[model samples]
Target: MRWFGFGFNAFGQIYVHDKLIKGECSDAVKQVKVISPTELASHVDRSDCCLKTDGQIRASWSRRASLHLGGDSCVCLGGFGAVIASESCGISMKETPGCKDAFISELYLTLAFPDRIESWDLQKKEKTPSWSMEIKTESSGPPLNLPLVPGGYIATKPPFYRPLSPQLKAKSLALSAEHAILLSASGAVYTWGLGSHGQLGHGDLTSEEQPRAVEALWGMPMSCVATGGWHSVCISDGGDLYVWGWNESGQLGLPSRGLRKAPQQQSSQQAATGDLYTWGWGDYGQLGHQTLISSDEPQLVEFFREQQMRVVDVVCGAWNTFAAVVKEEVACS
Candidate 1:
């Protein structure tokens, strides 16, 4: 069986693929199914299952595949007699009363016989609610690379390609500007551009051209790394949380108003010490401190003192900081 996938990337390229070919193919093609919105609504119910006249609901065949049906795009499965709701090419079933008689953008239709290559041909049906079907075949080449944007990029390891060095494998598998953080398997942390207030943890007040390793963090072995708009937080293997970059709001949890142009050592004093520290500007409560002071050096913040909750994740936005902690579940007898 051939497995196909499609989606849009940060570079504005539409990625569509059929995973049965070797290496990369010189030409790739997509088959789409179309149907009228009125007819679609009658056949499929709000739950996305097909409804029989007797009210028996059957499972939808296109549930596993990604599809879009309304809003900016729409898709219908003509042969399967079903319509799907989607966004950005992924499939979801949402009831859209406005889309009652609208057009379907695209749909994935599986061919019955793969051995026989069938060409697409447009046909006109002699029926009311008149409509025409236009089918054409085209060749596709290798997938193209897209340009970097402010939000960054998301990617998965290609099945055919292997990293030349072990180091590359531990690198970022995917990244985005808002809330994506990556920690390589090797324990090193590399951050990309957009460190307005020292969020990149370079110990400097500049944005980086490409991915750069956090110097002071070298050899320490990072367990996790989190990125914010202008600041960054990281957790070490020893269960300590270190923060750096813009601290205008006490987000860095330190006292003073100097940006930490570098990574400061956070104390792992006790497991209950909170291990949280901050550096840089502090205008708002972002630093989680009493006064609005900034510091170039690392200062400790003692929030979460009683719980001593081990922070598993930390994320920063333009001016907000958030941390995720492990929650204990009560045992049921």
Candidate 2:
């Protein structure tokens, strides 16, 4: 398997062979911005054991984490070309065998276990989690779940929890910088919060104080939904993809005449045949187009296709992108 990365690398966040000293070199000499797709070393420890993403790839502003080997191991990378072992951060997948996933951020590393999600603060010396949220394992739970709020969805302070809107049983939830989206069990899509960029998919740029069903997508039976900085995308049951919201950089895969770029906003997809495509903000080469030119339309990332590599999965970061790829097997008659 191989991995490819591109975009802002000022801190070596996307992985570079040499260690980067912030102030030691000029901006041009630093080679901080990668304007094309480049191969990233598979082994973070420089060892024979290559990093694997058997499960998922999660990213933060300046770091990336890959969970592999049935979640038994987690490999983390930062801008300085250092690999942080899970054990070093008091995260032992072996001890907590139930750990199924993880989330990374600028200040926290969260682990999702069977019953709860624990968050550890990177700035603190202690390895204990500063906070955690309980995850209901069973399909049945308190009827009233979280409700959409101004900046995000909220559950009342713990110990004295208050559940609101019991009727809305969301099967999946996604949160952007300023809005929230939910997919109900019936496959209906609901959105709320900031709508200045029309991310709510309500056909208007009006903010919603409460969860509002996206009428445009009514009866479509969306199977999956995702939100970016200020845009939204969802896949219908029939495999049709729907997109809305800010298209400044053409993140929505729609025609955009204006060049009002929205940094860190982009979209990507892996085709059924294993091809990968990216579009939107490319100022930092996040689009993997080999050029620092933003595209309003989806462009095929030919590197993988040219090398006979099939992209199995893809994940986008704040300013970069990562793809999990494998060599395609050839048949001899």
Candidate 3:
């Protein structure tokens, strides 16, 4: 159960202390914490918080608001100031949605939410966090991290794949500042969350709070999907690319500041899809076009075809567009 801390030095969040009284970690030391895992376990909840980087205060186990520990509480779990342990006979964790947006390292399981994240130790040969008692908290934030675990690689766990929708198989996912989109295995597209710019592809400007299938592209199996700062893009199986949402930076691969006329809503056709299209926020040349003109519609990038090349894949970051392609022989060759 060794914990290795390596990252930027802007913060002292990874510092560990040897003096353990069952409380907060001290950042007075400049070295990484290792050699022992018990002290780390007792203070793991404190390690995950970035807000308390000063590290001067020690957490008391006696606080009524804190989790009650029992003799079996050799293992501890904490996140976002809330903690529940095997010794805490009052807590049960079965009802909450399991942790997503997290990473499982060799010795630690880091569950990251939007603002903060916490880590739980995986006890391979030690005491496991008992799940018999359900854990409850006063906070309304979504509780994450399910199934107290033993030390092992995340890949070795018993199959944990659960379907979001029994009928729809998700093929790909993309997220913007406040919205997200999902593509189904069968090529049906679903978009939800802040739809002010028509990023949801529902044909009008409105936000969606839940997953809604994009009716405009029904039956057209999408091979690829991508998103940037405020826009979204998807490629159909027929080698055509579609763009939507905020185009302030030409992210949609268009030439001006207006949305392209969406084609008449037609059912999808079964065709191979491949191509790179970008729109929205092209001030950084993210659209991949040679110029810096912003666009509101889908435009084909001619650089690849003009040079006898074929695109394998394309990805857009906050301000840049990257593509992977296979080069084709030109007539001169």
Candidate 4:
């Protein structure tokens, strides 16, 4: 698919498909659709593409364009905001009904595909927009190239929408894809979707509908977290390591044969003050436990202790755990 990037340059101008289009377009000439604040609870629908008001926060997205309100009571997407009017292609602020109290900062429009047109406005200091864009492009053919304001255009693709979790708040949050990691604001860790042998750390044999907090370390302050398709790991503020989920390959660092449906604290021998402990199923010694047995709880892998390492980060892949450890030096008299 062909992709294009467009937005405001240092010099405020509306560059469409890399070519300047509107210069100082009047406020009345534009129309913005404002979504009801109540609608925030509902799943964004593609039919709600337009913004009805000017200053009010609104959002719209399509295969070609994604719009967000700007801090200057203007609108911007895929680019910066507060464009000035000039002969080349500039945007200007003016009094309008949508933003009667504040001046209209900018208006952005995107044509991501042949038949898709999306637009919105940017208002000031609104971290979350009142509305969200609904992408509707769907076709087997390659994506389309749509023109944008300011400088570039974008190559659009068919929309990809995952159902919103009923348990999740209407606000913004992140989710894990295949091997990616997600750390929530709250230090608790959660994993889902796939758990071939127990990779999703819910401590059960089944997958989860949404994220569930890891209960074992509820009070422990977590600094970072990571997840694999069938395994998961987390680091505490005190530099301790905790693991759970799948352990078929000794990945859990334990000496048992089976999966752990709950987060288990690693044994003191397996977890020194700063040593990295692994547990789960260890088939290829991936758990560093030096054995090929499944562990139902956390265990210490002796090999990691000899190195006197302090783990800084841990990432889990489909079957491999990549850990970064800082080797500490012993002081001699």
Which has the greatest TM-score?
Answer: 2
> What's the TM-score of every candidate structure?
0.36, 0.79, 0.41, 0.34
Stretches > 4 Å off in candidate 2:
21-29, 46-50, 53-55, 69-71, 75-77, 80-98, 134-136, 139-166, 259-272
Please identify model 4 stretches exceeding 4 Å from their true place.
1-225, 231-271, 290-294
lDDT (Cα) of model 4: 0.37
- Which of candidates 1 and 2 reaches a greater TM-score? 2
Candidates, ranked, TM-score: 2, 3, 1, 4
Off by over 4 Å in 3: 1-163, 258-280, 287-311, 325-333
After TM-score superposition, what is the CA distance of residue 29 in candidate 3 from its true location, in Å?
35
User: How close to the true structure is residue 11 of candidate 3, measured as C-alpha lDDT?
Assistant: 18
| Candidate 3 per-residue lDDT over residues 183-288, each given as its tens digit | 7668888887788887888989998877898888887788877655467789999989888887655556565535444442332433223444544544434455
lDDT of 3: 0.43
Best by lDDT: 2
In angstroms, what RMSD does candidate 1 have relative to the true structure? Answer: 18.8
lDDT of each: 0.36, 0.67, 0.43, 0.37
Candidate 1, 1-333: lDDT as tens digits: 111111111110112123211223343322221110011223233433222221211011222222232332222222222222222232222322222122111222111111111111112221221222222222443221111111222121112122223343343332334222446668887766666666777777676665677788889987766554456778888999887765664556665444455675666655432344544444433344444554555555554343444444333322223333443333689
